[model samples]
Target chain A: MYFENFASLVDMGGHGIYVWPTYALGLLVILYNIVSPMMARKKIVTQIRRQAKAANNRKKPASSDTGRKVNSHEQFSANGQQQASTTESSRTVNEGE
Target chain B: MNWTFFHKLGSPKWFYEISGKWLPWLAILAALMMATGLTWGLLFTPPDYLQGNSYRIIFLHVPTAFLASAIYVSMAIAGAVTLIWRIKLADMALKCMAPIGTSFCFLALLTGAIWGKPTWGTWWVWDARLTSMLILLFLYFGVIALRGAIRSATTQARACAILTLVGVVNIPIIKFSVQWWNTLHQGSTLKLTEKPSMAPEMLWPLLISIAAFYLFFTVVLIIRLRTEILDRERRTKWVRNAVEAGARS
Candidate 1:
């Protein structure tokens, strides 16, 4: 029987060099087809999460209105946290600008 | 039968909800069938008297070849439905089928090559059947590439629909290539019209394997269609709810 040993399957009646590679390639293609969409889904989910965080941050301003408009950088840090302790504090500072 | 349900079929949300109910059953049945088929094919079936152990590759090759063609035909139908009826789910199904069809085509080619080396004394040949199958692979790549290159989903779907219709012409070419030209590729072993040429021991597993492949194709297609639906409907309330629930978990 062909199942006599691992070597027999590998040898495949002297067709090993061709047969084994074909099986290997077929298995690889199947594995990749199953795995790729999963990876793409992960990538998309990460992008959507980042977009939602940005949209939420955009809705709330960092400081109050002033005689002169306050720049976003002056009101909040690059990381999107408020630099001004309170809107009142920033309003006083903004009048000078 | 309720004809009004035809209108409901056009709705993405309805299909998504319905598909969710159907997917689990399809998956479970597919797994069961595939397991039974492969087990019967790999173990219990006796070797061929003429070709011996190498004939075993037939179990893998023929079924995948069958699927490779069937998927393309199904895709063309979905493409037609999407173009004429404007059913978004049909468009999604056509898109999802591309990768699955490509995978099956690849398997058919690979297994055929393996079988050829043992039976035909070479791993590769430019025989009519093989050449036409290679063209089918290229046609699949063309469809995928054209879809990816287009920026708008609707436009892309339309373009793919047209391309799929054009590719349908190639399917017959592949089928008849063996007959049209004398080639190294052997004629089909199993035929619907003729009595099966193989012994019962070999024929049974081969039949089981084909059924298994059909089930496996359905399972993968449903999973892919679900993913496509969710992605397309991300802005909808149901999708948003699903996303939030998923995020929480």
Candidate 2:
């Protein structure tokens, strides 16, 4: 070790305040770079899943009149949810592109 | 030059598949190098004759400063390729690099200020080197903002490419700033044409740190680029299959 002991290493000969904070900030930036993209990846995956589900729903329609009404209502709500989430994801993905 | 490789470079799907294999290797190498370099720089290297322990900041500062300028030049080159060839993948690279470059620029500024506090007796000065670096940060912000503001991809790419090329002028200015004018910031210690002024013990760890930082940048950029490819090509069959496979896993 360059220093004699732990305390002195942390003290860094009275330059600890400046040196430590710089390293801390550097760590923060590095962590942020890793994290922000991972979050973006999650957002994109969610969007793709939502779209695939919607496409599957469209391909198979309900048969009975009662079933159609219930299915229509559920589909309406799902579409609303997908629209809200798609807008959010598209904004992030657009910034990334 | 085989045109097949040049043409293949334009394919986002091919790049995505290839980069996925490279990612883990790059990440492991980057992490190992950075861990070794930081440990050596912070714990093993001897103190400077004048700056004492505070000089340790150079390990982080120099690498980030090098990245900040290097990434800009790369972004500009990507921009040039995009403008000339109209390659979507190149534009994606150009766009994705902006935020990473911005973060590094911010790091350079922050670390420079921190190092200055003890060494220069002040946090900041409106000197040539400092001001030009700040401008580099703004250039990154402008590219990112312009990308967000423009809706059409082609227009956004064209405009950003023009801006990126124009901003290339500042890089040479930043490189020569300390020499051209009187400045508080010191001149370059490491040079391409000659040996570094620093001792081998200090220089070796610094060289390792610089290499590690570049590898780290590649890892992050590739990750971001992969995400860009997926998002842009979301409607394609391969993307759907990939997403379904991901869902299954």
Candidate 3:
């Protein structure tokens, strides 16, 4: 705004070479800071989901073997709740004991 | 003193939930302030009498330098909390701060070098202030490397904390290097106890930029800390539920 025209603003009174690159680099650094963590977050969520899915898959067959074929869906839900509780207890025990 | 707040911070899940609520506001404020400051500093602010328009780099240089040192001090404080309280959240914070701090340190060095070419007529120098700052960057690397080398989380946290505390001794050296010894790098323009040498137009945008950088650091730190919390607590029920819900959505 201080400059009279667009050319002067870009020229920065002949210091544009130094000034512009510095600002450009600064912008790059700021963008990196924002983008890096979001990428990491995406990777972490995907990993956690995969692990959760695998754990559910591993428990599904065991629950089916113990319950009747007709009630497999209900048995699976009950087994999931039971598995979650057991894992919670085991985690506490591992931490405390 | 009400110590409940301090105790609550010890819980990673609580911190994660609270930081999630705060992140959007902080990120928005940072973006707005930075955009305002950059526009004002780059175009509206007048040129320096001695250095001319190239002095505009100060807007980026000063904020990055401030963040470089400030982030290290914070990492040290978080390190102390981890050491004393054995708070996993504090360790998580300390771990997350390193890479962010390192990037800021790199920026400060890079900007200073670029500014130096126009002002001091050289891109690099081995003077006291510059050397101390370079050492600070190395110290950041040391902490990060130490963490990576150790496989045990408990051991890694303890070692990184000690290294951070040790590296903090360099901070005061960096602060005093310009005054204590001859250096091409200039002394502080903005001071806490006295008036800054800069004019109001230049100073105002610099102040805004500093605030914006701090807010940006906080937003990023919180985001990193949340990811760390989820990673460390993945085996817990809350994390399992959260991840499952996230996947469903």
Off by over 4 Å in 1: A5-12, A16-18, A49-97, B1-3, B247-249
Task: Give the range where candidate 2 chain B is weakest over 10 consecutive residues by summed lDDT.
Answer: B240-249
Q: Candidate 3's residue-wise lDDT over B1-249, tens digit each?
A: 986677775787777677777778888998999999888998899899999999999888888899999999999999998788777777789999999999999999999998899789999999999999999999999999998888667778889999999999999999999899998888889888999999998999999989988988988898888887777777677888878777321
Per residue, candidate 3 scores C-alpha lDDT tens digits across A55-85 of 6776777564533432443243311222223
lDDT of 1 by residue, B198-234 (tens): 7887787788878877877876776677666555554
Clashing pairs in 2: none
Residue ranges of candidate 3 with Cα displaced over 4 Å: A63-97, B1-4, B247-249
Over 4 Å off, model 2 = A62-97, B247-249
Look at candidate 3 and tell me the lDDT of residue B116: 90
Q: Could you tell which candidate, 2 or 3, scores higher by lDDT?
A: 2
Q: How do the residues B1-249 of candidate 2 rate in per-residue lDDT, one tens digit apiece?
A: 796788677788888888888888899999999988888998899999999989999999999999999999999999998887767788889988899999999999999999998999999999999999999999999999988878666788889999999999999999999999999999999988997899999999999999999999999999888887777766567877888889311
What proportion of the true contacts does each candidate reproduce?
Answer: 0.10, 0.51, 0.52
The ten-residue window of minimal lDDT in model 1 chain B covers: B240-249
- Ranking of candidates on DockQ, top first: 3, 2, 1
Cα lDDT, all candidates = 0.71, 0.84, 0.83
